[model samples]
Target: MDSPWMKRSRRALELRDGFPRLMAVLNKRKNFQTIPSEVSSST
Candidate 1:
């Protein structure tokens, strides 16, 4: 069985790893939406 401390640390590590990936996805989505709107407005 895993210790509580180990489990907590593992969860924290997962969050640390996942947070950036989540941010990147959100940033990419924002960029995707903005780019199309800008292109449409320009033309």
Candidate 2:
């Protein structure tokens, strides 16, 4: 018999695996937004 808790825990593990990649993409987007302004100011 399949347990609901087991299914939930499996889903949680999948989310944990993917969360870092998601954060990296978000951080890249944040850096992309800031870099242009910094370059413009420096030039």
Candidate 3:
């Protein structure tokens, strides 16, 4: 939606950083890291 929505979403979330940060760090579906990983092994 808008910038405000993004920031508010971050604050409201029980988790932190990820969902809101995705707007920047997320490039493709394959680029996302969802669970615990070996850094080079999963995501």
Best by TM-score: 1
> Weakest 10 consecutive residues, lDDT, candidate 3?
34-43
Ranking by lDDT: 1, 2, 3
The sequence of per-residue lDDT tens digits that candidate 2 reaches over residues 1-43 is: 7699998888678768877985686578788774445423632
- Mind sharing the TM-score for model 1? 0.49
lDDT of each: 0.69, 0.68, 0.50
Tens-place lDDT digits, model 3, residues 15-40: 35455655344444346655323323
Highest-lDDT candidate: 1
Model 3 regions lying over 4 Å from their true place:
14-43
Residue lDDT tens for model 1, 4-37: 9998899788868777885676588788764445
Task: State, as a TM-score between 0 and 1, how close model 3 is to the true structure.
Answer: 0.26
Query: What's the lDDT for candidate 2?
Result: 0.68
By summed lDDT, the worst window of 10 consecutive residues in model 2 runs over 34-43
